[model samples]
Target: MRLTSGVFMFLLLVLSSVCVAETYNMETQFIAPIKLPINLVPLVNEHLDSPFERYGCAASLRQSLEASFVRLSPTAEPSILVKPAESCLCGVHTCSFWILRQCGATYCFAGHLHAHSIEINQATLLNDYYGLTGLPGGATSSEATHFLFDGKSYVEEKIEPKQIK
Candidate 1:
């Protein structure tokens, strides 16, 4: 009976490791402060409110992404692979992707500011970035919810990632 119990315990340990899901580090960048179009200025003025109001674009984006991530991944512990900096401007858009790769991230949450809106998208990191497709095991749509700032709060929208195949 003792030998049987030991075998069962060993099997449980091995199975538990296999069942554990991979944890991803979350990183967000505002890219830059948005310049709204003339027509949309009024609409955004009312809705681009953020908790880190005093912080600049980069911090604000990080805060917003962190908040949303917590809501989406209630059980997962939060981790930030990228160190906080006063700025996060990579000259070219593609340069930012290189930064993420260097940081050793399995996932990244990014927010970009546009003429009339703030867009948020999450992507997986592997050989390349994949949007909603090729997610790690056990990932769900909630974890990859594409959102847009609607002048009041983030609203779920279907925004496709550029690098997604």
Candidate 2:
């Protein structure tokens, strides 16, 4: 049996919507000693910046941290979300969050963001990766930033204004 053109188009739209509707949410938990994959450790150390140079970079990072696992794509490996502990690692207003994803056999840095919270968009995508929204921290008038994966790393796409309710 052959399908009509209009039927084929409708099926295509349904499949595309199904793909877009798939999303993953990451839940962060505090981790002491900052346990991570051996291969990812170096990448994280190199990417993260610490204010305390005296303690050394790795030492400062290991001091206090939070982490979560997120799979941005269905067929891809899970990514790690590393956030600084509020007590030691956070800045005055916001803290940095690092995303590490598996690139081929080795894990690589996917993106870095500074915000109070990072949320994965449920129904938006770019380059086969999920979109993210970073909410600002503190009482400042700063706006949220939206990021989308460009096949390599997450880049800022737009500044989203705060919704007043």
Candidate 3:
């Protein structure tokens, strides 16, 4: 129930394109263009849910969560990542997570990207340096992020806060 590497890798390209409008003082037109994996596009065009549909994909809910789990998860071995969407709208899907094995320990990550059926509102999306946004009911309106534990030490990082140009 997870997106394949090609699928997520394509999303990464999109993520890479979306440079925060604030830091760069760029226009919205420059936001990362959505180029989901071509092979998976058909399923999405048909409005079908990918394997990432089940869990909330909630940043916290996913296994050893990681944004790139859908693509680069297996390489890590004993790691995990959680998907997004604790309460998805389509009942089809919203987000995903991944975990991989690290040196003698497990590293978990929570990712929310490459959503297939989830409707997106680019204008409302937090166009910050980190390309993250918060939501209501505990979801941040700027960036969806939180502290994660490596099962040994806690990694301190969050989506960069959005700032005005």
In terms of TM-score, the best-performing candidate is 2
RMSD of each: 15.5, 8.0, 16.6
Best by the lDDT measure: 2
Question: For candidate 1, what is the lDDT?
Answer: 0.30
Writing each residue's lDDT as its tens digit, candidate 1 over 1-165 gives 999999999999998876554322223433332222243222322333333322435534343122112112223333122222222322111111101111233433332221111111233222232221112223232233433333222334566666867
Per residue, candidate 3 scores C-alpha lDDT tens digits across 29-148 of 213322222333232223223444433344322221212222222233422222232335222322322222244442322223322222112233121112222221223322333323
The TM-score values for the models, in the order shown, are 0.25, 0.68, 0.21
Name the 10 consecutive residues with the lowest summed lDDT in model 2: 22-31
Residues 7-88, model 2: lDDT tens digits:
9999999988765532222223543324665556567677766645224434544545556677676567777777654434
Task: Rank the candidate models, highest TM-score first.
Answer: 2, 1, 3
Number of clashes found in candidate 1: 2
TM-score of 3: 0.21
Better of 1 and 2 by lDDT: 2
> Where's the lowest-lDDT run of ten residues in candidate 3?
21-30
**lDDT values, one for every candidate:** 0.30, 0.68, 0.30
| Position 31, candidate 3: lDDT | 32
Over 4 Å off, model 2: 1-34, 53-60, 159-165
